[model samples]
Target: MKFNYLVFFALCGFLNLSAQEYYFPKANADWEQKSPKTFKIKDAPLQEAVAFAEANEYSGSRDLRIAIVKGFEREPFHQILGRTKKRGGPAGMIIKNGYIVAQWGDTKRVDMTFSVTKSFLSTMAGLAEDEGKIADTKDLVIDYIWDGTFDGAHNSKITWEHLLQQNSAWSGELWGGKDWADRPPSDGDIDDWKLAQPKEPGTVMEYNDVRVNVLAYSLTHVWRKPMPLVLKEKVMDKIGASTTWRWFGYDNAWTEIDGLQMKSVTGGGHSGAGMFISAEDMARFGLLFLNNGKWKNEQLISEKWIKKATTPSTPNANYGYMWWLNQKGDRHWEGLSENIYYAAGFGGNFIVIDKEHDLVVVTRWLEPSKVGEFMTKVNAAF
Candidate 1:
């Protein structure tokens, strides 16, 4: 009887592991869809959330080129420097246990996902750390690039962690985009920002595109290949994303690495180019994160990296490594789990992961302010 009990316990352990397994979609196969009733989710609240998202479509022009210009008119000399696309209408998907429980609009339509690209950029850093290409996030940037980009005393103090957390305070210009000029303080003029002393590294969180591009450029040098190719080979292709997705950089964002010229992709669509991808692909990426960087049997990104990437940074409790945290900060979403984290972009594109419910919510082109309420409704459904 004692031997029988031991065998029963071992079988139970195997069953528990199997229960936690996620369903991974095939590369070209149809994504399996599950009904909301399967999870005992309330139809009214679920439909309400979907309605809110659909009704609150982003106010930006379909011609994103005009919207881009109007959005950042305060910035000096900001223009469409790279590629921009006419955006599609409201689109989204809600994945429960790696299966689509609800989706709206065209999940297959490709659209620009502005700073959501930052999350992807940070993923490259995570990948580099996993492959030992980056020795440590705490290591200084000069140790890798050795370029004049990190030359100044302020920039010299910058580290990989600083950049990842957006607290680098690295003053510089890259691809003709000035750090200060990218998003200057509204209180003061151009000269004030130009001469303003940079904050100490790892002390202040400032959202600047040039600094983000610096990260992309530095990662390019470290990987010894274009970041887009690296992401495709290591991540997207493995996750079965469609070929329609494209990562773009400024026309001037090219660099010669090992006798080969490659474009250093932007971290956002601020000046036009970043990630142009489908909502379906975005959901897949979110599913990977929701599963803690694992895809079926393959651990594509280390679990350690995903944890670090999602953890709140010291300078900004509401921000992680290029990802947004739902902690009680300025950007906290009320009536939702504080543990939630998401990738947000300029025009209300979001890939929210609620681990507590095993939910991956991908919404694009919804009005930014309505997200909290929409999420509140989603949370109520379960």
Candidate 2:
């Protein structure tokens, strides 16, 4: 029995080693064949980077510290151990001047991007406009979604811009309580629910999932196809996203947003969590935007569209078309005249694009934390 137990442990160890050996073959291949190897900061500069990061108020920096302290409890090692405890676990990447500068964590592991997907969806909507698929942002959402449920006076006046800015004025707790992660509206009583419009569009900034859902529904109506299919064909395939990664709608169907039951036009569907991709793939997306929608001379998204999406157009002055505008200032309020914009997810996931610095930083984590301090530190370094 003792001998058998020893043999079993040895086999398990061997299997784990084998899995680790091939953990990032794709990343290795990309390094060797697809692109140049990622640049690494030297030890002296790295120490300064660590110190700067540690002193920041950013949750990502703290999380990185915690991750190190906890010994990385996850998989895909890439950094150093002991001083940080774990090497690489779940990955993140930074791009500057069209080259990958730093990468940490599992470079190949893909995970849910949550609301950062909104930024991409907004980009698609911009494309839809450029292609003449959708007329303009001011177009009435109800014109596209003529479903009987939207007949209420409030719902009739809602526009695509309103949905994009979360100013649709619809009220209901979509992100709280039992329905926190995956709760859909009642289908049987769908028509019975009434949506209230805000006193005026662009006056208020309310972060609601239902508004995004309405955007999804409206886009589907205009495109005459499912959101995921549109995204896959229009964006993902063009970008050459890895086959191991998949973007899901609400549900499982390729055509369905959240499963086949719900449509993308449902309120808050566009803003809340619905899309999934790998960290590296997300970095590619950030790079695309950093390059003004150009990828190696191929314009996947129009430069005009990119500018409008990132530029602020609402009263809040901190939001653009489904993206967050980062201004210069302290923790109290966003200061004036800053050129940074980012797509922020619920937790600590961020794809920050700094036009002034010509840099893009992408990060992902399981915990819900802010990266402001970390951003400040990184920006200061630059």
Candidate 3:
């Protein structure tokens, strides 16, 4: 039995070594090496903020203090990549009282934000509504999109609200097929890829990427500009996101779709996928939403729009207009709350805002381990 135990321990050590060697990059990449000009928190008293973050118990080894301290000197993106690659854990950021208080891992590194881009798209939809470019969420997509090619019996019933809520009933397979990647669609061929719609819209909460693509298409049809440009001129510019950040789309005009270059997409835009930005800038976005779309005294996104975007319009928990709602309940289950909304991407990219506590947390990483525990610690600190 003792020999068996020894063998087991040896195997475990080997596995750990392999994991470390496999995941971590040998030489630090650009994201892993960039640092923020200012890493200090300006909202609450600094000592108190530090104490609060220190009080929380993260699930990792307590010996992590040395690494955490080393992170202070490292670039935010590198720190996050290091932790994610080494520990296979989530990165974190915390904003309290309108100032960034604490962060862990590669807090500033930008990665694919996955569905979180949906929330941004939803905000744009609201802007369109406010501009009278779109009448309302209930407006049929055909109203905005030209060609009316998608005006089938099933698709005809799809509305802006249906798409926003991820209930457009479109098959995800159409966009996600392996073959589809090889034969990329032409600039104008996006409409030809539309698939058969489901039986009903809004009856089920199906997370469909194609619906988001259609939303982008609809936006382009109305604004006569690419989705990214609209987002840049309206959202990113208004919020003062750093020039370092890039939102991907087709053509430099924002209509081109190179899968690798464009991270944020309409469904999950290219920019959002690998949207690169400093963690501080991501915190700025959180603060902008926390203040109900006001940044530096500028009314960027309207309060009404913010509220509507974060509020869950479907039965799905933690699902708002493309944002994830984080409520206080079972950690495994969904449904955060109206007070806390987040822009979450896959592999654990997050921009979390706690309105009641005046807190925002942003994290970017390559994996999803320990995210729950990290979030728990952050919540406790609040």
Candidate 4:
């Protein structure tokens, strides 16, 4: 009777192991695909979502350098300070229950992801938190780096959480970029913005690339190595992301850490350099998040970190740790779940994660205004 009980338990374990649901695409191999019908998804709505993305291509010129200047024409000294690439046409893939249900255009073409890089940057911080590198999110920046970066009275109160939530209001210049010059208030003149009183740390949310770069700079100092290398060795390589992907920094963005000169990557392509990656890889990243940071059997990032990263900040209900939330705020999608959160970038690049449906959608070069509607259409099929 004891032998029979043991045999029954072993059989149950085998059955549970065989019941794994998610599918992770192998590196350099053909990704497995499935039909929408397999999951009872409405094919017409799914196809319409793809067509809507393709038809609503970003109005910006394929020449991103020109687009960069034209889009941020208001900001003073906004030049292509780093490498910018001519982008490919509309491209995307829809992952439902871990298999590709639909794909459009060139999925493998490497293109600039612009501010979508912030999500990855946030992941670095999450990894740090998981590893105890960042002792606490509330810890003051000056505690980690005694440099004059956090010397000012207002800047002294800035914390890691504030930086991650885009509310740090970090005041200073780094890599030839001034804190106030980035995406300044439209109603103010250059001198007015420069002289404007900085907001209290954690009091307001501002989307400033200069401050984002400061976070990158701090993370670089914390890791004691290049952020890109840390990303590749720790996350990307483990997730089987393609070799075609690259993270870049401004030409002048370099620092000496431990007597070794390491380049600190930017969190966005506002000044031109950031993550240049394919749509498939972006989907893979979204899948990792959908699985709560677990890549297959290994947890690349902790679930605790993900919860903290996705929770809405007091300043911005629609924003998290560099990730945009669909929490019925100004940026919320009309019909989509409030739980949906995504990484958005300039020129309509996105990595949308819908964990409720086990769905991951990556789209590039779609019109920025059409994103909420596109998501609405995509979710309709499910």
Against the unseen true structure, what C-alpha lDDT does each candidate score?
Answer: 0.92, 0.56, 0.54, 0.91
- Model 3: residues with Cα > 4 Å off, grouped in runs: 1-91, 105-110, 171-197, 250-266, 269-274, 327-338, 366-369
Q: For candidate 4, write residues 114-223 as lDDT tens digits.
A: 99999999999999989999988889988997889898788889999999999999988889888888887778578988898999889899999999999999999999
lDDT of 1 by residue, 191-239 (tens): 9888889899999999988899999999999999999999999999999
Where does model 1 exceed 4 Å of error?
2-19
Please give each candidate's TM-score: 0.96, 0.68, 0.64, 0.95
lDDT tens string, model 2, 1-382?
2468656876877433322221121232373212222233343443343344333322333333343323322212222211111122334665655456556666577555557878877876887988988788888876766765256776677777877877766433322211111222335342222332245656766665545655665677667776667777776666666666554444321223333444442221132226556777777777677777766546788888887786676566678888888643222123322778888874456788876656667776633333664565455444
Q: Note the clash tally of each candidate.
A: 0, 32, 27, 0
**Candidates sorted by TM-score, descending order?**
1, 4, 2, 3
How does model 3 fare in lDDT?
0.54
Model 4 global lDDT (CA atoms, 0 to 1): 0.91
CA deviation > 4 Å runs, candidate 2: 1-90, 171-199, 251-273, 328-337, 366-370
**Shift in Å, residue 115, candidate 1:** 0.4
| Superposed Cα deviation of residue 368, candidate 1 (Å) | 0.7
